[model samples]
Target: MSQPRATAIGFTAVLLWALLALFTVGSAPVPPLQLNAMCFALGGTLGLIWAVATGQLSALRKVPLPAFALGTIGLFGYHALYFAALRNAPPAQAGLIAYLWPLLIVLFSGLLPGESLRPGHLFGGLAGFAGAALIIVGGGTGFAPEHLTGYALALACALTWSGYSVLSRRFGTVPTVAVALFCVVTALFSSLLHLMLEETVAPQGLLGWAAVLGLGLGPVGLAFYTWDIGVKRGDIQMLGVASYAAPLFSTLILVLVGIAEPTLRLALATVLITGGAGLAARASLRRKPTVAVSASSDG
Candidate 1:
């Protein structure tokens, strides 16, 4: 696939991700496990229907069990930590911490075959981290001791997502099939967790139900499939740069929705993150020529 097309797909996925916190915050009454279970269950059902229609359901049986297991755990684990992070701390702060996965992806991309860690990537990542620090410190909450658990969970969320993306790339699989399996696994695990650990909390109104449906159809389902394809076939460096957009978009959306107020700290964070991502992606300017494959229909 050409870089531009793949990057577009990745961008769509990130755009959906920007709405995640807004929906999650709106569903504050719902437990993470229950939310995860409901969203993934809906997503998995959608994916299954798509797969069957596309004749990909048969391919699922051919995928190795280990790959299924890894994909499932990765999908479930990241959200589990992320949902906990949102519940434990202010959504904006916790969101920034979890967004660190992009930088981690850039750094860890070096572990994959033929990929190298470049100086621009490292420098940009540091700048982004500095920006994140500004947001955390100046974000009104000011590092309260009570929110430490949220911070920790957010960090784990970053690690889990980074690891998942890198590992998914390292192990090639059919994107649709893998995503379907992972969603199913996540739904099961989250259901179990909900049953064992959470009290029942149902969506109360139109907005609440909308949040659940949007999350199910977008972030938890289609977004993951697109992301898998992007990371596997798209320019990894470019995706790294594009990913910072997620947090920027997320924060802006929250502000628009009145969940958060615009602040100088956020403005600076946007500049820093955007600048850093541009610098990091600058290395992609030197890519060697490759055959352009049409990826638009692949999904």
Candidate 2:
């Protein structure tokens, strides 16, 4: 992909991520877990069929299956944390905290590629950290002991997501759709495991029911395709900048729905996150891919 289109695709993925947040919180009567499982099932099925029909199932075998597998499991955690956080924390707070994956990715990138931290990276990192701290202090939802697990899960979600992003860079030729397929496959297994070993809850109504499909088509499947193609084909770092938009969009959705009460703290968080991450990602954008891997390595 050209740099411009890749940039658009990345930002577009952020919109998809935001939509995932919106539907998850807005699905009032749906048991989020069940809905998640249903969505992944449908998405995986669709992707699997498409790949097989096109004789592209071989693409799955060519990518880094281990990294992809771990990433998919992380995606499962992300789904759970996001759904629970919406109920436990304010929508904006949840969005902000969850989106901290960018900083986590930045930090992790330092460890992986031995990239020296730049002035912009330092300031950006600080900004994102401060933004998160401010958001936490702004107090949309009180930090309760019950909310402890939710917060931990949310942080884990961010970290795991960062890990996935870094790991994805290891594979050079894996198609974006293949990545989506792997994630959905992993999610399907994780959901099934949850259903069997844990308590299962179902959506309460048609709106919630439709949310399952929407989640699959919009965020779970298509978003992955957009993101993989975007980041994979160009500067992954530049593509990452679009992620900051997710919280902004989520905040708007929350305000429109009357679930998120506006505050100056949120505004600061937005500026810090967008500005900081953007600065940091710009530094990363300077990086050129030094190694290439074949899809055959996936098997």
Candidate 3:
């Protein structure tokens, strides 16, 4: 397919994957390592399939090893910290904090030349954080001591995500299939760790096993592959923008399941988040003006 069309679809795929991730949180209560192992095991299979189908498996070894290693380490770090934070903090709060990854990305992006935040980004970041705060504070639970600890870990998750984003950029031009292969390899290694350290592989019967595989094949693997494709197709900006929808979807799921309830404060927080995100997205959509005029730009 043409690049533009591929990019547009890729953004949609990202939204789907993010949504799947939100739902996958409470689907099964297994240990995070076991969950990662299962999901990644599935990811390896799926990634291998795509690689073979695309006839790119032969070139897979040629992908820069350092970049792949960084990506792998980034993945491992984010998930481990995230699982640890979940031990202490409510998942909703922890998840919300983790969602700040985009903001983290924006902050880090400034360090790199040729990438600067625009007015839209400022507005979006504010709005996104506002939404996150709503999701964190308004989720009908008071903050516990563990919550604070978890929040710290959540911040680490954000940083790890930023690291992955940077690492992935090194292979930004690489095909999504290749990236998927690297992720699959990372998943395989993580799964092996699960076997060696934990004596894991919970025997929760078929349904439990299904959840594990779903975590891996569906959200972890399939969704990620689509996302990689989106990145390679040059829709990272759009994909990034749309990804702000993640916490909102996740929050709604929790609320619907009675895990969280809505309050006036929560409502207000949602408004701020929505308003800010809307403003930011609109701002980002505006065209950049010529260098002749930098004194002011409404967007």
User: Regarding lDDT, does 1 or 2 come out ahead?
Assistant: 1
Assess each prediction's global lDDT (C-alpha) against the native: 0.78, 0.64, 0.63
Question: Lowest-scoring 10 consecutive residues by lDDT in candidate 2?
Answer: 290-299
Q: Per-residue CA lDDT of candidate 1, range 1-299, in tens?
A: 66667767877888888888788777668877898898998888888898888877877787777677768878998988987898999877887788788888888887877676777777777777667656544635655779999999999999998888877765654454568878988999999988988899898788888888888998777888888877876767567766776767877998998988999889988888788877777866654544443343447
Candidate that would win on TM-score: 1
Rate residue 1 of model 1 by lDDT.
62
- Once fitted onto the true fold, the runs of candidate 3 whose alpha carbons sit more than 4 angstroms away are 1-7, 17-27, 88-93, 111-113, 139-150, 196-206, 232-238, 254-270, 289-299
The best candidate in terms of lDDT: 1
**Sort by lDDT, top down from the best:** 1, 2, 3
Ranking the candidates on TM-score from highest down gives 1, 3, 2
TM-score of 3: 0.79
Provide the RMSD of all predictions against the true structure, rounded to 1 decimal.
2.9, 4.4, 6.2
Counting clashing residue pairs in each candidate, in order, gives 0, 2, 1
**Model 3, global lDDT:** 0.63
The sequence of per-residue lDDT tens digits that candidate 3 reaches over residues 1-299 is: 44445446555554555446454554456656767766776777887787787677776777777766766777677788888778778877787778777676655655543445676766667676776677665545765674799989988898887667644655655656665665666677767767776755463667666656666766677766666555444324444545666656656666777876766765666676567656655654573532221111100
Q: TM-score of model 1 relative to the true fold?
A: 0.87
What digit string (tens of lDDT, one per residue) describes model 2 on residues 1-299?
45556657656777886777667754555555666666777667777776777777877776576766755666676676666676676555565567778667655655645344556776676676676667544555555666666666667668767777766766546666576566666577667766765676666588776766778777776676667655444445544444555666666677788878888878878888789767867776665544433232211
Q: Can you give the TM-score per candidate against the true fold?
A: 0.87, 0.76, 0.79
